[model samples]
Target: MSDNPGPDSDPVRLTAWVHGRVQGVGFRWWTRARALELGLVGSATNHADGRVLIVAEGRRADCDNLLALLDRGRSPGHVDTVVAQWGPARGDLTGFVER
Candidate 1:
């Protein structure tokens, strides 16, 4: 198998800040499950300011799917807004974690 991603298989990093009613509500666990399902690797960490930071590295399409899911209003907590930043994937993460 090739190490390089094909044209449509470009990898990316998705960093999303999820706001509102997300702390202590199994949000990170939910995100970890979804990320793993999508074959992504990263973490969903709780911020001191009551936000959940979700970072996932995988194919752009899979990452986008996860982002869409986050915005679809069906998560464990009520999500007010999701602020996202995208960049090239950094192959430094292992399995997804809830931190």
Candidate 2:
């Protein structure tokens, strides 16, 4: 089989819990923008314990790009750490949402 992934190959779900000064700094909005740009469908939600949860589903490369961006600390607020989990895509989310 070819090594390269086709148009819809390598779909996955990225569950990333972002820690640090993320809430109240337009972080979710920024995440939504980035996810939309990457053509990923998911939601960025704020937890009561000062953590931002990001769930993105799309091509593996695209999800990887988002994770890299989160780790680069170029977002709205300072990102101390990014805990990520990967799995098969559920294909339920529509557009990216900031919650």
Candidate 3:
């Protein structure tokens, strides 16, 4: 196996809006934990409209996994819908944080 992914492979950034019952429910904390576990770096915060805005940068597959996890919900909240916006990874974030 090679040590690098190759020229065609690149890090990915996700701007996801997790909607429905996501505020004031420790979802940000849970999201941070999950992102850290996936070795991703970015931030998660709650909007005043009851949606969680999560910006995560990492491997595409890992971000996908995180999306799947987010869609299924964790606890104290129900994830009704997930709006995903994918793009080139910024690679600027340090660690998972709450913003």
Candidate 4:
């Protein structure tokens, strides 16, 4: 990963799994909206084990903000336990899509 942030900065890849009462609510939509607002590129999907998987690519600060937002803006009866990993940076995604 490069240390410098530039105009052509590559998008940082992040894969996060949100646990707890994340499903059955609008968590996925909420995530997608936030990602779009932050100009992030990736997808958010619901796992079979009552967890939500999110793969987002964006700037370091934007990614960090997403994590914080997820933690803070959880829906009622929503509890999220997230685990994230950084991957190779990529290009800007077209839009946030639910899958």
Q: Which consecutive 10 residues in model 1 have the weakest lDDT in total?
A: 3-12
TM-score of each predicted structure versus truth: 0.92, 0.92, 0.89, 0.82
Candidate numbers, best lDDT first, in rank order: 2, 1, 3, 4
lDDT of 4 by residue, 1-99 (tens): 977767446668888888788887788888999989998988889889998998888887798788788777555347656788887766666678888
Off by over 4 Å in 3: 1-9
lDDT winner between candidates 1 and 4? 1
Candidate 2 positional error at 81, Å? 0.1
Model 2 scores what on Cα lDDT?
0.94
Off by over 4 Å in 1: 1-6
* lDDT of residue 13 for candidate 3: 93
- For candidate 2, write residues 19-65 as lDDT tens digits: 99999999999899999999999999999999999999999999999
The weakest ten consecutive residues by lDDT in model 4 span 72-81
Estimate every model's Cα lDDT from 0 to 1: 0.92, 0.94, 0.89, 0.80
What TM-score does prediction 3 earn? 0.89
State the lDDT at 52 in candidate 3: 91
Which segments of model 2 are wrong by more than 4 Å? 1-8
Alpha-carbon error at 66 in model 3, in Å? 0.3
